[model samples]
Target: MRIPRCYEPQPMNPGDSLMLGDNNVQHLARTLRMRAGDQVLLFNGDGQEFHATALEVDKRSMQVRIDSGEAPKRDSALQIHIGQSLSRGERMDYAVQKATELGMARMTPLFSERCEVKLNSERQDKRLRHWQQVAISACEQSLRCTVPQLDAPEPLDHWVRSVEADLKLVLHHHSATPLGDLPRPGSIALLIGPEGGLTEAEVQLAMASGFRPVALGPRVLRTETAPVVAQAILQSHWGDLAGN
Candidate 1:
């Protein structure tokens, strides 16, 4: 049977005892209904996971004892940073989750002229937390040792000017170049737009900022789907997924 992995904020080490809190405690006690001596894996976003056994279960917290275990090997070789235009509710969450699973080093939610969703400072903060959790859950599911970083959301124009990537791409249906045309770089950045897509002026702005326009295929993909496909293709081309 597969033991469930949990993300704990506290530090973990062999022979250490820790208590689960908040939703994590509730998840272990209620949802998983884990009994004493049940095996579970725990990680703290530190590129290592602890082999743990539940020691006690109560209303407030579930306690576990960590055991000596080898850390999981890192899977991604080429680092990818995704700059994605904000989409609606579940759409954005899906993209963030999949990007984490695909081994993105960092993520930034961008605001383009054609974007339909707009957020104030408060809403942006809440969304950033939500996206980080989505990424965490994805890492747990994929058994990734490292969690991807989620950067603060910024306007398309400003973010484009600030990034200095070894390879940068802005997805456009009318682009002449394909991602396959470029040699793999140590670090790559992919910029994808929302449903209505980026305006011509915005495309020109991206181009002027040193971002090459790359087309995925003949058909245009949905905002959420585009990043997943693009990341998978790039990974298979030069990252760990290659030759596998």
Candidate 2:
């Protein structure tokens, strides 16, 4: 059987028994009908994963005995922080999910002029939690023991100015620059626009803040597709995804 990988928040020690969270209990016990002695993999986002077997299972809760810990080395060497303009509905979720699987180190959703989504403080918090769960789910599927970072949504200009990286790039097809011309950077900050794309003024603002305009190719990609394509290129050339 495929051992299910799960995200647990509590600290883990080898050879210890602990209660899985309520959510996990529901999923494993009630939903999946998983019984005692089934094997599972658990990680707490502390850069290691614990192999465990269910020790007890019941309607309300479940316990697992931690067998051993394995540290995964799958993270990209190139630390990328995506300052992506917020798109509405599932588009934003899609971006976060794919970007995490692509090995993005950090992400900040940006409120740009072209962005259509609007949120009050309460809604923003809820959306943040939803997006975080999306990323966590991606990590479990991708076998990444270390979870990617996702920050609260902020204004585009503010994020552009504050985001730090060895190389900063903004994807604008009109620009003459290409991704291959730049020297290898240990870290990269990539800026991508929303559905309608970034305004000319907004692009200029990012350029003023040290983000150089670069294009993935001649064709213009959708708001949700740009970051994934850009990340693949960067990782292939300079990051951990590169292979012989």
Q: Which candidate wins on lDDT?
A: 2
Tell me the tens digit of each residue's lDDT in model 1 across 1-244.
6788888888888999888867777888888888899999888888888899999997678989988656777658788999999999999999999989989999999999999898999999999999999998998899987889898899999988898789989999997786657876989888999999989998899899999998888999999999999998888887888563
Candidate 1 RMSD computed on C-alpha atoms after optimal superposition onto the true structure: 1.4
List CA RMSD, all candidates.
1.4, 1.1
Model 2, global lDDT: 0.91
lDDT of 1 at 158: 92
Q: After superposition, how far is residue 97 of candidate 2 from its true place, in Å?
A: 0.6
Evaluated against the true structure, the overall lDDT of model 1 is 0.88
Best by TM-score: 2
Q: How high is the lDDT of residue 173 in model 1?
A: 91
Please state the error at residue 36 of candidate 2 in Å: 1.6
